[model samples]
Target: MVDLQVQYQQLKGEIDRALAAVLDTSHYILGPQGQAFEAEAAAYLGVKHAVAVASGTDALHLALRAAGLGPGDEVITSPFTFIATAEAIAYVGATPVFVDIDPQTFNIDPELARKAITARTRAILPVHLFGQPADLAPLQAMCDEHGLLLIEDCAQSFGATYAGRQTGSWGALGCFSFFPSKNLGCYGDGGMVVTGDDRLAEQLRMLRNHGSKVRYHHDIIGYNSRLDEMQAAILNVKLRHIDRFNQLRRQNAHYYSERLADAGVVPPREDGKGVHVYHQYTLLTDRREAVQQALTTAGCASAIYYPIPLHRQNVFAAAFGGVSLPVSESVAARCLSLPIFPELNQEQMDRVVAAVRGA
Candidate 1:
């Protein structure tokens, strides 16, 4: 799904220097490097605060915490996403109301989400799946009308923009992951929560650090989820080149879309509202098994984002046994991600397309 080694090699000098700096300081926790990255990230996203955390899961968990979600509350979201999106809700003792996704965008359907809301619904957590922003305006309006919060899972959309604004700036709180495969990844695990609300920002900071504004003085129950300084330093270096990287990804996406159309593979459709950063360049194919086998035989790699919907997962079977999300299930069966790293060459892309067509 990604070529992190090639990406790293492109920035070896900067990355090495950043790592050396972190080692010199010997401050690996919430040190100056992490603090600086937070500020830069906030500014880039047009948010007032960006709280760095240990992982994207932590960012989602803490964002829900900052939004005042708790036991028995429900967070309506798409069932066709990474487990972390729903897992964070479960971690906070909140029920995840799985809704069917829009088959075209592969994002939570606003109509379905609005229909799923109940008196227990406290928030709407929407994942910007495949680096395209969900239909956020309608979802945001829904949240506003129902007095619910809006949190964006932007783990795959670091530099993506929606309706002239960056994705993280649209929702009340936006969570991002710095996993090595993401658009703007660090060396290891790291994540961030961006928000414009001062109150929410302060709450997030406290919640990420044992609920203490001052060291060791616990005010509320919280988790130890601070971002590593070394990761932060590396992210800072990579952040400087994200625009160029994403531009290359966009170019590759356009090329693939054109070629894949000829191969009978349905390429991802741009919703036309935001910049689609082409995070994974996923395709929907009914012949997944055949296509995957063909690609493997040709020494090309392909992946399925989610082979099973959240509602069908064994862990949540008791709560969602009767739930029927046909679209989510359909998408889970058909969705296949191909090689979309920014560094992939034209020859590599051509080979992948040829393999899929051959299958």
Candidate 2:
């Protein structure tokens, strides 16, 4: 759904120079480029530390491990999200408790998350789905009252804000993905873990490496999940333009919302508590298949973010089978993501709107 070639061409000079510098240095792993990118990302997010990793999934796994979560621990999260949200918790040997989402915002419902808590509930992992931040004030208050950790899955919310503060600055740990399609994407796979705590930051850095603070002196078991220097360099160039890109995305989303006001489709909601970056301008329609087919026939691309909720996945069905989550299930079956990228123009957007109206 993204035109990476066009984006690259727009930032050609800076990206080419950055890659050339990395090549000249020949330092591929956790080198100066990665370190500089981490500092820039930390400053942008207003967090004390940002630990770069190989993938977003790795970032979530290391964050959970640093928080001392393991077997017997439970993490409450929404079912209407990318599988990696739950996979990270499962990777850390923690049980993922599925909660329903708010139908309007399509985010984890705070009340449902609170009700799902138990003695074993150690953390509340919330995803900022489709670039809209979850209602974090209540979730943060609940975490404080229960002595639970709060983790934000910010894979699609790179430039979003809530309550006048950046999204990744909330919670104990905020995980981000730099997949090429994200708002602040790099050339390839990359991710980061942001935190305000120094101790947790240290643990995350060591864990991303082979648990060796000092060379060859392993302190604990860890994983090899370091961000590549080249990708970091590319991200550094892209980061400089992320705000402008997100603003364009917001404009495209507004056009879509205005056009589809009474077209029997539900556009994404902006709750006034946060600014949406429009990672995906998703629409909800009962006739999802027909709408998508129309878009395809009209040369417009569309996709479903998640057709199956986490609770119904075959891998987790044995444990969460027969669970009834009306909102998440219904939303998953009807949600359709439209072509939303900074490169899209008015002509493209009009075509998509006309196709939807025709459908």
Candidate 3:
């Protein structure tokens, strides 16, 4: 379905040298490599500060904590994302307010979000699900009108832009993940929290540490979520090629779209402001189970972004008061993520389309 080995071999020497440099430095935790990566990432996102963290999940937690989310606070967000989005909110003892998704973009529905806000709502965490940026304008306005924070869960759309700005920069705090399979994946687990407010940025830096900017002097309760220097080194190498890699993924997506035209599937959303990085060229179809079976039989692979909506999950069932989100439930049942990556060749893409068409 996809391949990362080609990239490893293509940049083997650089990676080897980078890894060796990490071993030589002996300053493994939040070392120079991590600092260098932070600057690079901040520049890439056009933000003032980028705090590297342990993983994408940690990025969310740090962002929430920095924004002052805690027990009794409510964060309105869609239920159609990876569990991490809700988990981050719950980590701080906050309630994850459930909302439905926009039928077209598979992102949080702004109208639903507007309806869900209340006095308890302290933040609105809109996810850029499946590489598509959520509509931010209205959501931002809602936050402004109600004095709520905006956090973007950009785990999939690391390089995606919205309305002339990076996806992560649109909100108060933009969180990212560099898991092994993301569009800008590292060698292992890594994450970052990007923000423009200098005060919030400073808080994130301190929070990732033990709530203290200086050593051995804790200011408040915090967690150890620092990014690994070695992983940062590896990501630095990959960051240099992410734009080119995204370009290839875009090209492959076009090929897949053209081939799947007759397969009775609604393609991923591609609109004016943002570019779908093909994080997963997902399609909407009722024949999800049959499609998966056929793709597997045809020597291909596929997946579902989520099989259950967050509101229905056991952890949140008792928190969200049995929220009814029809759109989220429907999308979860029908959506299928196809094999997509920069290295996916035309032949493989053709096989994927044919498998879906045949199914």
Candidate 4:
């Protein structure tokens, strides 16, 4: 649903030079490229620290580990997100409490999350789905009241903001993914964890490596989840153009919303609390299958972000089979994401809109 090749062609000169520099130095892992990217990303996100990791999943995993989450802990999160969100909590021997989402924003409903809280609840992990920032104000207050951690799953919201602050900077720790299709992705798998706390930052740095502050002395068991230098170099080049890229995506999304206003579909909604980066310009329609078929016939790409909620997935069915989250289930049945990217031209967007309208 993205045009990575076109974007590469547009930035070929800068990306090629960045890669060449890394190759010249032959520093493939935990080198200058990664260090520099972390610093640049931190500054851009307005966070005190950024720790690079192998994948977005690792970022979440390491963040949870650094936060001292373990067995018997419960992490409340939206069920309408990617499997990785819940998987990260499971990796740390914690239970992921499935919660419903807001109909418009498609983020975890703050009230529903608060209702799910229990004595075992250790954190609230909210996903900023489709580059739209969640309602962090209430969630943050709830965390503070409950003495819980607020970790953001910002895999789809690299440049999105909430209430004039960046998404990753809102919570205690923010996790981002650099998957190729993401808003600010790298050449391959890469991720980052950002935090304002000095202690959490240090713990994250150790957790991503072999849990070593020094060269050979390992403090705690850690994973080999370092972001490679090659990927970091690519991200560094892309980072320089992130604001422009996000702006273009936002413009395209607005265009789609305006064009699809009367197409019997629900266009993505921006709550005005923050800027939406439109990683995926998703719409909700009762005729999802027909619309998808029409797009395929017209040679246009469309996808379902999540066809089934995490609570309904096979892995968690036994544990949450009786639990009912009507909103998440209803949205999953109708959500259809159209092609969205900074490089998408007018013709492409027009073609997509025409297909949906014709359907």
Candidate 5:
């Protein structure tokens, strides 16, 4: 789905130098690189603080903990997202209230989410699926009216913006991932949580480091979730070129949309409320299996972001088996993501378009 090898070659010198510096210093944990990356990321996202974590899942898990969500609390989120979105709530002994997604944008429906809110609902966690920012205005207003926390799962969106503000800066706490395939990813597993609240930032910092502010003294139970120095160093180098990377993705996506306009598929729609970084150039087609087969025959790649909604998954089936979310189910059955990256050339895009049209 991506060409990491080519990207690495493009930044070989800088990445190698960053790695060498980290190795020479021998400060793998809580090192200068990680600290610097956190500050740089915070500045880029226009947030007050950013805490690096081991993985994107850890970022979400720790954010829920820092927000004081527990047993009886419920977090409203979309069922169309990756499993980790709901898993984080479950990790903190909180309930995940699954809701349907908007048909066009494929993000959590704000009206559905508001309807799902109950007395037990303590937070609304919105996922920016496929680097498209969710409609946060209504969701934020609903949260404010109910005095609920607003957390964002920005795992797929690194530099995406909504209403002229960055996605990670919209909510109380925003979580990001560096899973190598993301718009702004590192060499390996890395994640961050950005927030404007000072109290949440301190809690996240302590929670990531064994709940100790004074090194030895422990304040509460915490997990080992710090982002390693090597990964952080790699991220620092990549972060410098994130804007150009996103621009390329947007350009490539627009080209694909134009080519596929009459190719018997529904191109992704941008709501105009935000910038979509095109983490994946996904489209909806009734003939998904045939298109996938054609791409495979043409030596091109295509994937399904999610084949099953969260509420329908076996893990949550017992509790939510009877729940029905028609939109999520319908979209999951038809969505197919084509290969999209900053390095994608015209020849590659033409080949992909031809395969889809031929199918």
Candidate 6:
């Protein structure tokens, strides 16, 4: 949907220079560029430490492993998310307990999360779906009451904020993706884990690199997951303009909201304290399939953030045991994402609105 051609054209020179520098150094993995990017990312997110990894899935996996979560441990998370959120839990041999989402924000319903917690509940992994921040106050309160860690699946939210703070900093650990489709994406797979606690950050670092604080001396069983120097270099270049790009996305979202406000579609609702980046401008309507197809036929790209809820997914259903959540199922069927990016203009937005309403 996004014209990445335009994006690269604008930032081509800087990006090429960054890549050339990394290649000339002959250091491709976990080199100077990765370290510099990590520092900048941590500072931007206002967190103490940031660990770069291979992908958001690895970020979630390591975040959970670093916290000492393993088999038999139950993690409370919303079922209305991409499979990766629950898949990470399953990868760590942890139980993926399903929770419903708030009808408005489509984030984990804290009440449902609290209800899902038990002696086995080790963490609450809330996915910030479609770039909206989850309600943190209630989630934090529940986690505190139950002594559970909070890991935010921030794959969709990079610039989004909750209560004036970034989305990734609210929980114990925030896992972010740098997939090409994301707000601050790299050329290929990249991810980072941000944490306020120094000890936890240390654990995460060790986990990402063969569980060794010192080279070649293993402290615990870990995996091989590192942010390649090339991807890190590219991300650093993109980081400079991320704020402006997100602002443009916000303006485009406003245009769509104004035009489609009365198109029998429910637009996203932002929290008073949350600065939504509009990574994906999604809407709810009974005619989601028709609307999406109509937009595509009309030359406006459209997609569904997730067509299947996690609870119903065969993998999660087999691993997490049984659960019945109505809200999540409904959202999976109705929510649709339109072409939303920093480069999209008012004219394109008007056409998308027209297609949807016309459908």
lDDT of 3 by residue, 15-39 (tens): 9999999999888998999999999
lDDT by candidate, in order shown:
0.92, 0.94, 0.88, 0.94, 0.96, 0.88
Worst 10-residue lDDT window for candidate 4 reads 204-213
Question: Which candidate has the highest lDDT of all?
Answer: 5
lDDT of 6 by residue, 212-242 (tens): 8899999988888999999999999999999
* lDDT tens readout by residue for model 5, 315-345: 9999999999999999999999999899999
| Tens digit of per-residue lDDT, candidate 2, span 40-59 | 99999999999999999898
User: By TM-score, how accurate is candidate 4?
Assistant: 0.99
For residues 1-359, what per-residue lDDT tens digits would candidate 1 score against the true structure? 67788887889999999999999989999899999999999988999999999999999999998888999899998898899999999988999999899989999999999999899999999999989999999999999999999999999999999898999898899999998889999878999999999999999999999999999799988899999989999999999999998999999999889888878779999989899898888899989999999999999989999899999999999999999999889888898999988999999999998999999
| Pairs that collide, model 6 | none
**Model 6 lDDT-worst window of ten:** 315-324
- Worst ten-residue run, lDDT, model 2? 179-188
Error of 4 at 205 (Å): 1.2
Candidate 3 local lDDT, residue 91 = 91
Clashing residue pairs, backbone N/CA/C < 3 A, model 1? none
- TM-score for candidate 5, residues paired by index: 0.99
lDDT rank, highest first?
A: 5, 4, 2, 1, 3, 6
Give candidate 2 misplaced runs (Cα > 4 Å): none
Q: At residue 43, give the lDDT of candidate 3.
A: 97
Candidate 6's C-alpha runs over 4 A off are 319-322
TM-score for all models, in order of appearance = 0.98, 0.99, 0.97, 0.99, 0.99, 0.96
Error of 5 at 25 (Å): 1.0
Query: How good is model 1 by TM-score?
Result: 0.98
